[model samples]
Target: MTDSVFTRIVRREIPAAIVFEDEQVIAFMDAGQVNPGHVLVATKRQVETVMELAEAEAAHLFAVATRVAKVVQATFQPEGMTLLQTNKPAGWQTVPHVHVHVLPRYANDGAELVWPRKDPPLAELQALAARIVL
Candidate 1:
């Protein structure tokens, strides 16, 4: 994989509001604001999606995400926080590179995530769970 916008920022090839960085991952403020303290955690490598990341690389990315969540939680003092990661265009992943969105949430803040609830039959749900190896 070639360098992504995030990879460039990690390498200091582009200017970013970088909050934290290590050899494996980089955390920075989002260029666009979903919330006041929205942050993006991205891998230093150029893997395009979470599925593309090696196991070790994925672990490193999540570790950075966890740290960024703590910082955002403490500094912003939001009512809640959301960790979001989208994979591929079908999942609303705009960037080709893998990144996680650390969003600060508050009541009446208009950040709504709606999921249609369908109570699948108990047997179906059990079958699905059984199929999941993890």
Candidate 2:
């Protein structure tokens, strides 16, 4: 894959207000801040989606996101918090990188995650669960 904007940030080709970094991950302030403490935690390897990550990579990705959320929570003191991870374009993934948004939310915040409910019957749900059960 060609280098993503995130890859450029990781390589210092672009500037970012990075909050934390280690060998595998980086946490930085999002340019489009929906809230004051909005942040993005992403993998250093530049994988396009979460499904592509190895088990340990995925684990560390979220671990760092959790740590970033804690700091953002204390610093911003928002009414609520949201950890958003998207997949493909259909899943609202604007950036093609494995990252999670740590957003500090307030009352009446416009950020919305709405999905229609099917409310399938128990038998149908049970059948579906059986098909994908690990």
What TM-score, to 2 decimals, does candidate 1 have?
0.89
Give the Cα error of residue 57 in candidate 1, in Å: 1.9
Best prediction by TM-score: 2
Clashing residue pairs for model 2: none
Per-residue CA lDDT of model 2 for 1-134, tens digit only, reads 89999999999999999999999999999999999989999999988899999999999999999999999999989999999999999999999999999999998999998999999999999999999956
Q: What's the lDDT for all of these models? A: 0.88, 0.95
Judge candidate 1 at residue 74 and give its lDDT. Answer: 92
For candidate 2, the lDDT comes to 0.95
Instruction: Name the regions of candidate 2 deviating beyond 4 angstroms.
Output: none
Best by lDDT: 2
Q: How well is each residue in 13-113 modelled by candidate 1, as lDDT tens digits?
A: 89999898888888899998888999999887787789988899898888889888998999989999999999989888988889999999988988787
